[model samples]
Structure formats: structure tokens, C-alpha cells
Target: MAATMPAPAASGHNGRMLSTYPLLSSQIAFGLILAVGLYLFISERLRVDVTAMLILLALVLTGVLDSKQALSGFASEPAIIVAAVFVISGALAATGISERLGAWIGRAAGVHEWRTIAVVMPAVALLAAFTHHVMVTAMMLPLLLRHARDRQLPASRLLMPMSLAASLGTTLTLFSAPAFLLASDMLQRAGTDGLGIFSITPIGIALVLVGTSYMLGARWLLPKRSGTHGDDDYLRLDRYRTELLVVKDGRWTTRPLSELHKALGARFRLLGWLRDGVRRDDLTATSPLLAGDVLLVEASADELLSLHDDPGLDLNAIVRFNDTVSGEGAPQLVQAVVAPGSEFIGRSIRELDFARQFHAVIAGLWRREGDMADRLSDARLREGDLLVLYGRPSRFSDLAAHHGFLMLVPFAGEAKRRVHAPLALLILGVTILAAATEWLSAPLAFLMGAVAMVSTRCVDIQQAYRGIDVRIFVMIAGVIPLGIAMEQTGTADLLARGLSHMVAGWPALPILLVMFTAAALLTQVMSDAATTVLLGPVAISLARTLDLPPTPFVVCTALGAVVAFLTPIGHHGNLLILGPGQYRFGDFLRIGLPLTVVIALVSAWMARWLWLGGPLLPLSG
Candidate 1:
């Protein structure tokens, strides 16, 4: 998430005159007006970042907060920590450690659904909690989908589970969820105390268990869409088929296919031979003696094209140049899924200059629910849109490698060295040390880790920048001032007073549950960071008025805000998988609602046990 400016102080220059209005009512009214505007009109009309900026501007104009306060969120530690987390996550991805883990999981679990879910969910969650969920989702989603397709498992069965696993994985730590960071900052600002690394572990663990159980049950509840039965159609191995020609004047015309194989080694394979359009299945090592013969082969377009240009043989008359481009000069076809928070979202190929800038052609485009457009050039791409590109082989490969875009086809060519293993392990070690020893703050340790990644070349400078979600940073910077405004205007205190008056006779447990539910619901409609920023202070004020520890209520508000799963609007991770998972709007509601409820109940109880007294009782008015 991006950083936001805090609202100006109430007694500032403009506030000196605006002070004629009652501070508490005016502040509450201002906050309500902004919140309603965001919820009802701005949300549907403007980009979230734009709307957030508008809110920030509103706070400043109203004298609810000053310029410095409004911009403070950008400089906040939580924002820096999140930015660092993204960079580190990118470094890990560049090293292929995340892929190795998925490969290991696939190998270990093989095709068993239960075993796969069990190992994959917790593993991804634990790993992602420290890193960015976007990285985790990008790395794991395609792998899971491919594995499921290979094993003839239902995409419907596996995709949702994978998305959930990645989402749940992020909830394990504060840095894991952007919402947590925002809430933590708001709480600290409100003088309610900030959460330490692993401070939420007790409640987080319980939520995980409940969420996992809900997911396991959801496997039965979720619709089971069958995999495509026609493997040949989906696999499209025929597209990879090619024929090498042997001309009368060619140097290698007299050599057997095995001889060519021996020279080329395993880099190229000889499928069979074609003699005058007649198929020859036998690879007789000694059967040479042929001019004008054709060799049917299984090789990539690049390899075929490279051989086309070799001066050692006469390739002109031997090879038939079909629609397929061959050699390094030939265009390569690659498929990639656009991920959440990608800068490309909402832009068309024309606007992006995708072909001119990237040196690629948009061959095909796919969205989960929408009809495939006749031309990708005119279609606007959204997060989760799958794109097929025809481009220079090297460029296509490079695009897939660096950008978090998932290549639909199995990776071809030599694998990059696995730097992810040591880097991931190092990050884990640092996180553990910081969490356990408290030698350094989590943010500082993570920042150090990000620096290490850059210095060590785990991720390049370009990729590090690409990985950071500037939109989120902007949102954070814009919303922070509004949060500050709520506090300075006495809006939070007023809201808390009103809530306490209404729930005076109700048990504290129910009140806490209501607060948690409200936060969760609001998170679905608004930004999670904004939800926490707005509600956390109110929750804390309520606790303070009741003469109880503010920690439990504040923690509930924070956790509740982050646990929104019922809508794609709630979290970027949820939106990231929509197109790839082939999920509809209803799909999220079916699975996420129960999980949200389960987490809310469990988190509330855990907070009570850990922070509040054994059982919660109503406050005596």
C-alpha cells in the first residue's frame, strides 16, 4: 500500500477561524461526508488512488488537518516496510525459490487433492506472511493450475483453493497484510499502542486454523467445474511440430538422423523422418543415403529458425517456411497472465504502445467471463487478463521472466540459476531473528533484507522498482491525513460515545463482534487501509471509555479489516486470481463469506482471551 498524509491539526492557521464549528460534530460530519462520498459515488466513478487523493484534499481544505500531517503516511514506517517487502518478494521470485517450493510440493503430493491443499496452503501462507501476497499469488497460481490440468483435476476445484491459500498466507504477519500496517499506524497515532512483530500470532494462528477448516469444507461447497477432457486440443503439441529438409546439395543430406542427433546432443530431438511426404518411423542409425529427404522433428521455433540460417547446409530448398517463424529471427509465441496492481491494467495496447515499446504483437487475449475480443489491440486489459504474444523469442522470454506475468506454456530453454533458495532462507532467518530477539524492528529488518537483496543481486534495480506497487503507496499517502483528521476533529471520540451509548446494556463480546463485522464489511467496499484507519480509532476510543484494555478491540478492528475475502474489491490478491481462476463475482461470495465469519468469531474470542479478561461483560454506564 502507498503512504498517506495525515490530516492537519485542528488548531492550525485555517482551523483558527473554522473552530467556530463544534470540533467533534464537525470532524465526525467531515469524515462521514468523505466516507459516504467514497462509498456511494467516488468509488464507482474514479480510480481508488484518485478518490483517496480527493479525500486528502477535502481534509486539508476543511482545516481538519494540515499539509504536513496529510503527507505523513508516505513517510510512515509501515509504508516503507511494505515497499521493502515488495522488493524482497521480487528478489525471491527472481531466484526461483518460490517455484522450487511449488515443484517440491507438486512432487511430494503428486496428484492428491487433500495432501496438496494441506501442504500448499500453510506453506504459501507462512512464506507470504513475510513477503508480498502478489508475488506469492503470481508464483503459485499458474503452477497449481498447470499441475491440476496435468493431473486431470478440476480447475474449479484447485484454482479457488490456490487463491485462498495465497490470501491466507499473507494474513500470518503484519507485513503480510497492508491493512494491518495501516491499522497499526492509526493505533499508534491514537496512543493505543502499536503491535510488535508476531504480537498477533496467537489470534492469527487461530484464524488460520478456522479459515483452513472452512476452505476444506468449501472444497465440497464450491462448484466443481470439470477439466477439458480433450487433452490433445488443450496441449496443442501439433503446433510445435516441424520438418527439417535435406537438400541434394546439403552437407548433412547423406548423414542419418542419429548422426545429426549425436552432433546436436540432447538439445535437439529427432522425432521421425519424412521421405517424399511419406512418414518413416524407424530411426535407423545406419540408414543414411538420401538427398531431398525430410526430417520430421520436435523442436521450438527458435531452434528450427537457427538451423534455417546455418551456412554449413543448403536450407533454402529443404525447409518449408509455414506460418510458423523459425530461427532466432522468427517470432516466438508466448502466453502470460496479467497480475493484480499491474500498471498495464485499464490501458489498451494502443495507449501502452505494447508492440512498439515491448517489441511484441498481441496475438490473443482471454478474460474469464468476457468474450474474447476480435483484436487484442483495441481491448483494454484488466488484472488477471491472459494475453498471448508473438514476438522476438528472447524478448518474449524476458517479459515472462522479469515481470510477474505467468507463462502458460511450460518454460523452454535453460533454467535460470536457482537463487531463490538461499535468499528465501536468509529472509526467513532474518525475520525469525527479529521477531524472536527483538533486536530490530520488523520494518528495519525487512528493509535490511531488501537492501541485501539488491546488493546481492537477488533482484535487479529495474525489477525492484517494478515490484513496488506505487498505487498502493499513493493510496496510503492520501488516506493517512483523513485518518488523522478523524482523530483531531474528535470524530472518533464522538463515534465511540455514540456506540457505547447504544450498546450500553449489551455484553462487550457482542460489541466487539459487531465492531469486527463492521470493519470487515467496510473493507469489502472501501480500501482495507482506509477501513482500519477510520475504524481503529473508534474501537480504541470505545475501549478507553469502558475502562478496558484497548488492545483487544483495536486488534479486532485491524484483523477484521484485513480478513475481507468476499469481494474482489476487498483485496488485490483476490482480484489477481479472478481471470486466471476463471472466477465469477459469485464465486468469491460463496467461499469467502463463511471464511470471513469464521475468522471474525475466532479472532474476537482469541483477542478476549489474550488481552481482555476471560469473558467479556458489558461496561457499567
Candidate 2:
């Protein structure tokens, strides 16, 4: 009779399950939308913002959410703060604050390479703590390039480290990264105390210290690509091609070419030697030099300038990229680096025939490969390859646009409104103080700061508008609704239940650790903001299921999303340095793997200390 009772209960359980399945119809539709959304985001088949719009539309049509909920994200506080940050950061850059900071960095660095890294990286981290990470990285990029060139330091060594520091800065403040802002917004919407402006400072300071120390110590692990050496210094590296005539004053008439090469010593490369207007084909290291022989020498501007001191060689017509000859009119000298996704990658200058197509001379090629001087015409171009071209100014622009090249030299936009830099800095300080003291909300404080920037002419209104990244704004506004729909449709609960079941026996620390780890893994393939949006609801629900405060869990997830150290694509800051540093994908993994592990452990522990009390997990009654 007892066994028969069990069969009836089993049938009743099955019937209840069937009823619940029917009631979860909207949940099932939301799930399909989510799957497709994640696929579109990860595959990048469509623009992220466009994909987000589609997902929001699907949610409304499926009746998972009303139009109000979907559109609310556009006016959300987090989105406002994000857009304001761009304007503020642009003001800082436009008003010469960043450039002023560069001067301070240069002063602090003196002449030591290690000093530069120590001063610059931490300073960059601190500035980025309150501004856009990419703006900090981009504004400081040319400064570092110039500094590195002046000091004759390897650029690759400093660029990756700087980019990494920009990412680390996000951990220091709630508003520094979109992920943290979104996380804080989620916490507030849950009726919990949100993260303060500097809530993450304790853990952030520790991580920045660890990151800076690790980079300095693990310098050996960083790639030493010197092909891009001396990029910004005028005529610093292999930029001059001139004719040097062997003269009789020093009696070089019987000397071999080997002696000339040995004497030049890193100053120049021998291209061709001509005697009596005839190019020598039999030229060898042992070939005898003639008194009246003209040697085509490739050298730096400075190196060629100093050659006037040599009595044995007379400086003839400076044939720097045939600057003296022009079919397209007065030639302009421009330095261009290959942009990302360029078709020029893997193609040689000889194949493109710049001389025929644009009538431009590919005078110099700087690559990370280390041996680009001898084969400028035949060397295959790679992303980040810096080329010095001699051509008409208009043609240079057209060619750069046609090819995927970013002109870095003769850039007219570096003009900074230095007079207003002080005002900009003061405004930034006031904004931070207001938010930190709770005098005004973060969004309001930052928005006020942006307005002040325009009013003070720190950044013109047009510049402020241009600074705003429309794609990110649209993406955040669109995807915030997805998180809302997940909660509305009970999808967040479903995921929370499943995750809880997976970690049922886990202690408190591991739960936080798992959240952090999951965030870190998801962000490598998607933007950090998107990762936070998708994970924020799940995290909140998971903490609720464990009967714990959601702050630690949410904060942990944000920290994980911020590091983005594992790959260049993980963050725009990383991508900004990719070509300049000429780092391979594996370089990020090698350096970032250990760094990511260290940050995860420290951040999880810190979250436990700061937000959680005694138990890592709540004790079951």
C-alpha cells in the first residue's frame, strides 16, 4: 500500500512539471532570443549595437517585456555617466591636461628606462581611474612613442604595459569602466547599497601594484621589437637617402667598400655606388672605392646631417625619397602606419607599386620584424608597419584612405588649449568630489563636468559630440533591456537555480571565485560592457539564492570583466596598443595568463573581506 502511494505522488509530480512547462512559454522564447543574441554578438556578423536593437525588438514582440522596459535603458543613469565620461576625457585631452601630464612624466622619468615605466604606468593608471581607458591610452600614445624614441628605448616594452595599466585603472573606480557602472546600476535597482565612487579602491590599489611590479619584473617576457624604434622623433631612424661622394682629401681612392661600411657603424646603409655616372654592378665589400665615386647612402636625418664633418665624403644632392624630383608637384613627407584589417598586410610595396599608383616613394619602412631596411620594396607589409612616404600631400591622404594606413605624423590636431587645461583639471576634480561625497549623483556630476568642459572651452561642443562613441552608447542602451527581460521572464532565476545546483556544496569563496572566473572567460570574446550586462542579473539572482548580499558577487564580476588582459580584442585599450607594440596574440596570453590568475585570486579574497562577513557561504538551516 505504501509503494502504491509512491506511484500516485510520482504521477502528480509529472503532472505539475507539465503545467510549469506550459507556463514557461515566454521564458522559452526569451531563451531562444538570448541564444541568438549571444551568437550574433560573439560572431560579430552584425554590429553589436544593431544586434542589441534586434534583441530588444524580439523581447518586446515576444511579450517578454513591454516597450517601456526596453526603452528605459536609453535614459538610464549608467548610460548617461558613460556618455559624459567621453566628453570629460576628451576635454582633458583637448585642453592639454594629458599633454601636461606627459611633461610631468618626462620630468619624473629623467633618463632612466625603468623610471619611465614606474612613473608613466602608475600615472596612466591613476588618470584612467577617472576617465575613459582608451582616451588615456590614445592621448599618451604619441607622447610615449616620442619619449621612447628620444631615450632610444624599445617601444614594444612600454606600450603593452601602458595599455595593461589603462585596463587596471577600471578596477579603481565605479565609473571608470562601463561594466562597473552597469554593475552598480544593477545593485541599486535591487534596492541594495550600490558601489561608491571608490568602493573598489582597496582591491584596485593592490592589483595595480601587482600589475606594475609584474610588468617591471617580467620585462624579459615582453617582446623586444625594435623595428618600430624612434617612430616619432624627426629623422631619427633610417629616414634619409643621400649621395655621398668619395673625395681625395682623405685619399679613399684605393680603399674597399668594407672600410666605408665599418666606419659608418650603424649610421647608414650602402645602397649603390656610382663611378663616372655609371652604376657599379660588381660592387662588393672588397671592391675598391674611387675618389670620384658617388655612394647612395640610406641613413637617419641626424646621421646624414653629421656626415658633413667627414672630409673624405662630400655631401651631394640630398636624394631623400627623391624629394628634389616631383611629378605630382611639391612632395610632402608623411609617416603612416598600417591600420587594422588592412589589405596591405601580407602585400609588398613592390606589388602595390606606390610609385606607379600614387607616384609616392616608400622611403622608409619600420616593422617589428627587425630587418626592414634592406628590402623596403619587397618586404611584406603587416598591421602596425610604419611607412615614410614622399608624395603630394593630397595624394598621401587619398592613398592612406585607399589603403589602410593611419597618418601619424604632421598631425595638426595635437594643438591643445593649454590655457584652459587648469580649468579642465579643476572641473574634473570638482566632479569627482561631488560624486564621492554624495552631493550629486554620479551621472549628474559627470554631466555637469561635460557641460563645464564646453563652457570653459576646454573642449568645443562639436569636439565633445565627436568624442562620444555612438556604437557603445547604442549598445548599452539596447542591451540593458535584455537584463531586465531576463528577470521579467524568470530566466535569471532559471540560470541562478542551475548555477546554484552546480555549486551546491561550494563554500562562500568559491562561489565568488566562480563568478569572477566566469566573467573573465566571457569577456575575452566580447566587450566588457556586454559581458557585465549578460552576467549582472545572473549574479544578483545567484547571490539571492545563497541568501547573501549581492554587492560582493556583483563587484567580483565587474572586476573580472575589467582586467581583459587575456587578449587584445578583450578591450579597446589593448587593441590600441596592438599595432604600436606589434604584439602577437600569444604575447597577451603569455603575459596576461599569470596576471589574470593573480588578479582573480586577490579580487575574490578582497571581495570576501570588504563585502562579506564571516562565512564564505550562508549556513543552511
Q: Which candidate ranks first by lDDT, i.e. highest?
A: 2
Task: Give model 2's TM-score versus the native structure.
Answer: 0.69
What tens digits encode model 1's per-residue C-alpha lDDT throughout 1-621?
Answer: 123323354347567766656775566668676766567432568776777777777777766777888888788877888788888777766665665666566666567776677767777777677677767776666566667777877666766666676666656776777777776776677666777777787777766676666777667766666534333333232123334566576667676666665433232555556676676766487788377676544443334434544433323222232333323565555667887777888887668766656666554454655543322345688877766555667565567775546455622322222423576568657865775476887678878888878877677778789889887777877777766777777778888999999888776678779889988888787777777777877887898888888878877887777776788767777776676556678988888887777777777877887776654332422
Alpha-carbon error at 596 in model 2, in Å? 0.3
lDDT tens readout by residue for model 2, 1-621:
977998989999999998787449988998899899999999999999999899989989988888999899899988899999999988887765665675566667766767777887799899899888888888677667777777888878888888988889878898888888889889988899888999989888988998999898887899887434345432344445446778775646688888766545343688877788787878899998877788777765434533543556655432333443345556555677888898788888778866666667665555554444333456788888877666676566577566477655741123346456678889999999999999999999999999999988888789899999989888989989988887877888889999999999798788988998999999987778888888889999999999999999988888888895898888888887788777899999999999899889888877887888643333522
TM-scores for all candidates? 0.68, 0.69
- RMSD in Å for model 1: 13.5
Which 10-residue window in model 2 sums to the lowest lDDT?
317-326
Question: For each candidate, how many residue pairs have backbone atoms clashing (under 3 Å)?
Answer: 27, 1
What residue pairs clash in candidate 2, if any at all?
A: 508-616
